[model samples]
Target: MSIEVGSKLQGKVTGITNFGAFVELPGGSTGLVHISEVADNYVKDINEFLTVGDEVEVKVLNVESDGKIGLSIRKAKEAPPQEREQRRPQKRSPRNQGNNRREQLSFEDKMNRFLKDSEERLASLKRNTESKRGGRNTKRG
Candidate 1:
């Protein structure tokens, strides 16, 4: 059978690796389901969601000319729009977004803040280097 992109297929987990799991599709063809495509949330370990010999329905994401097939188990399982939206990260409110701080502060205030931070950083760097060079009182021959 020809494997087409976007087509859902039945596959069995053949192998598992740190990065992804290999699935054997119809016609004895194998494809890789990346760790990210295994589930909607973070997947630190692919073994947590799949195992060898497990039957799973996967969606064909891409079929490369080199015979590499990209598959996704999460995409195969359809979810309602509401659920999909819920899984997505929500946008932060304007008050919570700190990007507008520069716009809120005057130019003078920003300059003053920058000068203060720079001074503090310079002092810390000087102190660290002086200590590493056998202290400020040490004389070089």
Candidate 2:
């Protein structure tokens, strides 16, 4: 059977490497599922997820010009119900979770912090400008 992009196919894991797994499709065609495409979460090792002779469902991502087909295992699996629920925005309490005893900063406190930061920045800029101007004063007698 001819495999096209977005086509789902059942394939056997023929080889496993650090980067990806090689799957043999029905038509004797081999495709590569890159490590990044192996799972929804971070996959540190490909072997942890797949082994030789294991049957897996994969989605054909692309068929390169050189006849190499790219497959994705993560894309083939349907999203879990919990994942769908988590995608929705969650309601949060107005109170801060950590440091319950610590009160929120007052407006004056915020203004003071901003002014202190601005003063330090201005001082640094003045120092840089003075250094640049001083460096230009070197002259031959």
Candidate 3:
């Protein structure tokens, strides 16, 4: 059977290398499974995930004009239910979770804090400028 991009097929691991694995497709045609396409997790060694003669379900990612077929084992597998659940919206507590059990700050308090921080930053910048100018003026004197 001719493999096309996006097609899924079962293949045997004919060869394995540091970079990728070669899979024998249904029509006896071979494809390369790039290291990046091996799995969702980091694959330090291809042998850890696959072995020669091992059967694997792979998705055809590309078919080059030179007859090089690129396959992906990661895309063929379905994501775990836990992963799907984690992606869903979660409920959060209304109360603030912190060591200080004080009530949430009001709009005015927030604005005051922001202003204070801005003033401190401006003051720090002014001090730096003054120090640099002070050195220059002293050198000229």
lDDT: which candidate is best?
Answer: 1
Clashing pairs in 2: none
Better of 1 and 2 by TM-score: 2
Cα deviation at 140, candidate 3, in Å, is 22
Q: All candidates' lDDT scores?
A: 0.94, 0.90, 0.89
lDDT per residue for candidate 1 within 7-88, as digits (tens), equals 9999999999998999999999999999999999999988889999999999999999999999999999978789989998
Q: Which candidate ranks first by TM-score, i.e. highest?
A: 2
| Candidate 3, 63-133: lDDT as tens digits | 99999999999998856689979987685456435523434777798799899999999989987887787
Query: Which of 1 and 2 is the better model by lDDT?
Result: 1
Clashes (N, CA, C under 3 Å) per candidate: 0, 0, 0
Expressed as tens digits, the lDDT of each residue in 19-116 for candidate 2 is 99999999899999999999999999988899999999999999999999999999999576799788876764566545443347787977998999
Instruction: Evaluate residue 12 in candidate 3 and report its C-alpha lDDT on the 0 to 100 scale.
Output: 99
- Kindly give the stretch of ten consecutive residues in candidate 1 with the minimal lDDT sum: 94-103
Ranking of candidates on lDDT, top first: 1, 2, 3
- In the predicted model 1, the residue pairs found to clash are none
